[model samples]
Target chain A: MIGGRLGIIVSGSLTKGVEVRLDSAISVEDIAVGRYVTIEGEKRRFFGMITDVTLDAIDQRVMATPPDVSDPFIAEVLAGTTTFGRLHVLPVLTIGGDALSLLEGPQPVKTVPVHFSVVREASEQDVEQVFGQVEEKQFYIGTPLDMETKVRLNPAELVKRSNGIFGKSGTGKTFLARLILIGILQEGAAVNLVFDMHNEYGWKGSSEDRREVKGLKQLFPSKVAVFALDEESARRRKVSTDFVVEIGYDEIEPEDIAMLRETLGLTDAAVQATYRLARRFGERKWLESFLAIEGREELNELASSLGEHEATMAALRRRLDSLRRLRFLVPHARDNAIQRILDYLDRGINVVLEFGRYTDYTAYILVANLLTRRIHAQYRERMERALGEDIAKPRPLVITIEEAHKFLNPDISGQTIFGTIAREMRKYNVTLLVIDQRPSGIDEEVMSQLGTKITCLLDNERDIESVLTGVSGKSELKAVLAKLDTKQQALIFGHAVPTPVVVKTREYGSPQSYKELGFREALELKKKAEEEAKDLWG
Target chain B: MPAKIGEVIEASSGEFTAQCYELHQPPSFGSLVKTREGEVEIYGVVSGAATTSIEPGRRPIARGREEAEEEDIYRSSPQLSKLLRTDFNALIVGHKEGQKLHHYLPPRPAKIHSFVYLCDAEEVEKFSQSFDFLSILVGAGGQADELIAASLRHAAAAHQDPRDFLIKAGKELAVLLGGETNRLNNILRRIKV
Candidate 1:
């Protein structure tokens, strides 16, 4: 048999059953926790350190590795072989290294260089297995920061500040954000509003797809109202006029006017002048009363004197006119939806205003900002009432903003309402879960404020660097984030987790079947339906 | 009785029938035959009545030895002769491999056939008639000569009757020419020709 200095000698013949000790020849410095070595011609790898090494008292020449071995064969083998020879015979392997050299002498030995190998192969079982922790109170940003290791977070620490989820398309930003929301809602927290920009999150479940349906309803019930501003819905509702009226001059604050001026590239003086005009018109409700102002000449004359920025004033007036004409801004009816959402939130019910098909980025930004600001205001009022004396008992409100880069970018100037909420929401227990494709694309300030960051497979280098800059424990987390594979596989860092972990996202309520129908199936179904219709008609 | 010069006769069998249209005398003359909806030319050194009767509407056939030797000449000519008239300079120049012919000739059309009508004599002189004759050249003088040689060769071959060979050859030639003709007809129809 091939024999060498025993790098490690165990009490038992079988590798796994007994305690092992390294040969004195192998220097303590050279032996690593995960290093491998050859022992008695059998290849063996060791996890952790060699705990004990000593000579056998009964047999003067033999060294006893550790623990008492009663087996006669093992005892005889141990008596005959030197500790170095026994330990060295088996090969030591490293994760990315060549097998360790057989121990030649009793002197301390060095570990072999690692040869790269496919040591960890993910199997179908890995994909099918659901691995996560159910925690009390705060969201369990499941698993360790390393995608390979399982680690859980301390839930109590997570809810203190709002979270942010940001990544590029197909990076599992939406799925992870939904998981966090589900975690929080499942813990019996008051219902919070989800300003779903993509309309991907809040889906109603059907009887056949009961799991997904129940999961969605548990998160967002009928109490959660949906307002679709799509062309078809707008036309059908016939409330476009009221929508405009509801977006009254009051909706545009002085700061908002300043922002509008900046966005429109107008002067400060012009902005102040327009603000004054708007304030006066708003106080008198001239926008609402203008329709009753019988004389068109009088209305035109009144609109002209607004300011030197007559163009902006005219646009706003036209917007008002269009709203009235189309009956789109039906404030009373739309307000009912808004109020219902707020009422659900007040009753501790979660509300999701899913924006499924709104393509106009400008409109989405405007509406989401308005809703966030309104929700922040309500939350602040509730916090003040509940913890007037004890600021510590702050009612935590997790506000998950999907596609956050559109509204939360810090570069955009003027009082961005979303930015204001982001900055001040922390004091009122308003946490922001900012979800996007690339974390780098989100406002740097907003990213820095996110205490808990659950990062998934980030293909872009810049996005990975952005997440690294935001999180504190980069060593393990960076390695984990580098290797993320699927939608729910994420390296969760920040206050929510005790240590960074790689966790498979837990299923909340109903499983979402965003799996689109294939083209051929859809076509076949359409043809079949047409045939059936023809048959029925005949 | 021995066959007279230029006299057409039927070559018939239980399964086949052919007509010979005589072209020359000396028992070495070639003749064209129409049988079973196909036409072929054949040549032979001997002629006599066959055992079977000729089918109605089928014409008589003839074949002679000189026609057979001429066929060997047609088969040996290069492909270029089939694309252009024998008089064309390209036939002479292209016959030499690696010799450029572009300067003297227009680009060759995509599809070439033997029976295509040629009004240009320059094309006929430069290209060998065998190579230059397209499937479209059925009624052309060059095709008539080639047919005469082909029929004579068929007559000289023992296993297949000359008349039968001519009929089959005609049908095959028709099929080969049919594709190009249909394509040309389509082009003409598109142009409202």
Candidate 2:
């Protein structure tokens, strides 16, 4: 290899083993072992390691020998002294070159700090180049997938399931979740049921200009349906409304009833009585059952006796009151929302249940629990009917739970509806996309069960570690994540990506700026604007 | 003989002699009394008769000329508190004064409020030897002056600190004010304490 220029020869045992003094222009502090150093006229760079530093007498006799003869001569000359270890000025060079080059100065090298093989640059013919790189997919619930970086997902893998999204306030978790749902829907592979707690998604425009619509007439006019639950029609009329529905107590199986009873914090005796009451009213239907019990003092007396002997009367009364509030069992409801969901699933259309506006954590949990159990039961029944056994068959439904950590928590008294769905969903083609800012808080088993993961800018180290543990072959991806810009930039791993990619998320319609205004500030701004407009008008 | 109110006493026990500032009349038999400073509580027996050759206790009263001089100083001295309210303003004001102020001002005291008690004659004598009681009053008066100098230094450092506002201010001040203000750039190069 050609060398740049010759400086002072500090020490040399042989031509190749010379210590040449250099100037202070170069900051060699950052140089490392595996770096490639290029000479001024050389076509290729020589790779070298930083060996050692020496300061002492300048010995000119050592520089006389040639490159080929230098190794043995230097070893012999520097033997049995401290200079033997310290004499060699720099570390050993793996690449061999001419001896004459050693009389010249060392050139700088380009550092490769991270492990990544350079792939062929983007060509005109590549689909990615033509369409432009797929922007990062902003999911409502799953980890963020950066479109800029390339990741490969295997579609033929054994893990086929839905996902859940979860995070605390202002973590942009809901936005990420919606993006995941939109991606699945775009793929046209599986139907989805999104429990949108705040009614934030399923709108045509960005989050800022989102308009509320009852049905999917604007966006997915062909395949999607949006249903809003109405309270009045659900209670007065037994008839299902257009978009509202009631879950009949009779339809809930004994086991599911037990689970619900546990979730509602009902006592054992109350649970048993509710089950019996449900079975007795099964033949007459919900409205007729109420009518049948209206004037009957005998049934009341029986209830009282049972209440005194085995159950808390107050607890039973409260459970009955709760049952009355259920939208499905209420008569004259505008539409059975659950039935519509079932119908959509049957028709293989994705449904977005936007609950984005709801802040009540308990209400969100209850809705999620109800929907998941219903879906599970429906899937099991269908699978049993088709397979002649209770073996789970792949149903083309994926449920995406946004803010999933709240519902899937093992610490909660209720059954782990989300966790159960995550574990068992794959069997019935019911997949879960669990998205959370703090992935560490999510149940470890449920997180492990998620076949695919998309990760974004994770500020928390524990979340990053948990994500890394869940996905494989992501060492390079982890390094890339350290330098990611805060946009919707993210690294996607697991079955969703064949390889990890750092991607900037695509703008969905008009970008919805969910910029929160502090309560007082928003009010003040509104009042100020109104006053200003009025003044101008006057 | 019991000590009278306002009399000073030297309670001697070998080398331990405390000059007590008597606030109340000593009782018969002259019991020793102890009271906490800055508190209303009184403890112990009353001390015996005491006297001092030093000037009798006199309430502190600001002289008319001194008060007028203080008012003048307050008006002339730049409000460092207000100046430091905004980092940008602090930089501007600090750049204006710079090293000249630092040269005239005493070194910044380690503690802003330091108190030394003059409880007894021997303690008073020891304190008198170490520090001038008159100079202490003068020293206390110069606190605001010292603060002004420190504020200037802080502002000068801030302007040279490479922040966007400081850089802009430095550039503007150079164009408008001119002269050796350009030397403020050297402030940035200096090693921080």
Candidate 3:
């Protein structure tokens, strides 16, 4: 009903996609890229996702030169000439039977939006069926551009497997993550643990524009616990840190040091010396014992005694000495950070570990691996314990990891614990919301395991190629992906939506958007509408 | 409704080809013309129109071009124009039988030498209500785009509500040439009436 009769389909082949010229009366504001539309065909209504929109002059007559360039007559003719807009719409599906029947599931449509059909802005009814009914386990992620309608996502599908959000820098990757996290929080579908490397998501964060974004802690204060690695750093930023996350030196193993070899720029001989140190003094006290030998002669004497490479041991000892100011790497802890995290998940409280000022790649990767590796073991055990037991099923957990490609790259994927979690998917009640720019760098095993990929505008072909590795209908989807705007727009497909859709992600941090994000209003209306629909269709 | 413009010189089931009785002047392109054969009234729009010399085997030859004014040359060779003639081709769009005006092509062709008359405003007004003739105007082929523009202009002038008539015709053009907006715009811009 909104923007009634936006345009009429003129001509376009099924393979090339449909070209709909806008009505002469319709303004440019009525349509845009990532807008959802509907074409009323003879037999059925075909729904489309607008991948591209372009303005066109009615003819090449605009190229004609006027006799006098200064004359108003010439300008009048040029101005009065008709120019129209063409919306290149990719038909996603068709609906023929009653609305209730479509709720069963989406039936993939291969047919095009027919010739000369009336194309209009898709109504709320079309959107509801297209994204699937919003009665339960549904959350509105964003609104499609140029619409009053909200585009919802099924959270149950998202948390049941791994998913990713990718974009180049400043393309709102973190902002999108925050919006979806709000959806997850509102739906209460799963517990979300975000490893906040930039300390931006728990409290108020600002975009590059310096506009303030309302964070998870502000939205769900009681349910979210913000644990900062450095409490002093959090205090300076005016954020309340619930617990100080510190790892015991005892938790550091030879493999933990080995994992940091590439990051620390250590050689093969240096890595061998790290393992030799772990063998000489057990895994629990190896770093402490190795650091205790300050002199090169003392390190050489220890290396000689152990029959190891003296110079290599000296290089490894020198690298370990640089871990002086790390707040998380302490000599002892009252309790393990992994146990605290498990307790939070068991109680259904989401934990966001904020690395306040420890934003270095080396510091972030080292602590994240240590925490996630131990936490994975505990969650796996918990999932196994409740497999056949009378105990209640644990809540599903989503681990939000930023810079995911660092740990998930093919070179170290076999050694990293995330590779196992990515391969296992939802088995341990834990899945990843992998946030990164370089999806091309993430392991293929993990990339294929990703259920839903919400991608922002990415210009790199390799990155786009990696993001679309095993996807069906990639050529069409590629054009859609390539056309996404640099901001707010996203191509969301996989387990949740019925088909690949380029949507203008809803407003983030606006009062109106916040009201919709609350779910108290939208969800209630959805329930009432569903009940009414059932009354009629039943 | 108007005076007899011509007689049907050539006739077919789908077309009515005629020449102006005055020889030098043919009905303007897109002007509605009709012919009567018994109870059937065949209607068409001027889709193809031209003026040519009637001499079968020879082209008109100009003489003394430099010495004579344009008018004096014509005066010197009065017989040159006697062999010249004006004619037009029509796409048999619709017909009228009995008292009812039907918006479809007539089944039978108008007989040869049947008198063709220019349609009056009342007939143009009635046909302008619906745009069934637009598809045939575009499909008529030769100078079809120009025909569409000329036809809209002629129809608009003959109607009481000229703007309303043009708008309705524009909407029809939106459907037929929706993909061909370039041509649609060209035709629509010429609807000055």
Number of the predicted model whose TM-score against the real structure is largest: 3
User: Which stretches in model 3 have alpha-carbon errors above 4 Å?
Assistant: A1-31, A40-43, A52-88, A98-105, A110-121, A132-138, A510-538, B1-35, B44-94, B99-118, B128-153, B160-193
- List DockQ for all candidates: 0.00, 0.00, 0.10
Q: After superposition, how far is residue A389 of candidate 1 from its true place, in Å?
A: 7.0
Across B2-77, the per-residue lDDT of candidate 2 in tens digits comes to: 2222211221111012333331222222122222223211122221223332334633333346445655643554
Order of models, best TM-score first: 3, 1, 2
Question: Considering TM-score, which of the candidate structures 2 and 3 is the better prediction for this target?
Answer: 3
Residue pairs clashing in model 3 are A142-A506
B-chain TM-score of model 1: 0.19
**Predicted candidate 1 versus true structure: per-residue lDDT over A1-538, tens digit per residue:** 0122333334432232223444433333443221122222223222111222233232222232331236432222223222222221212121211233223212122332132211121222221122233433334444322233334343335556756665556666666666566556545443556766654455442231233333233343433334444435435433121121134333534444344332344466645654565566664343355434445465456556654344544454444343343233442333544455566566666666544345445445655665666667776777787776654443466666766766665565125656666666467777766777767766777666678787777767777887778443343344446666655566665665433445666533333322110122334566889999999998
lDDT of each: 0.42, 0.41, 0.79
Q: For model 1, state the Cα shift of residue A233 in Å.
A: 5.3
Candidate 2 regions exceeding 4 Å error are A1-159, A164-167, A204-217, A231-242, A252-304, A307-311, A319-339, A354-368, A381-395, A411-418, A435-441, A455-487, A500-502, A511-538, B1-193
TM-score of model number 3:
0.77
Q: Tell me which of candidates 2 and 3 scores higher on DockQ.
A: 3
> In candidate 3 chain B, what residue range of length 10 has the lowest lDDT sum?
B184-193
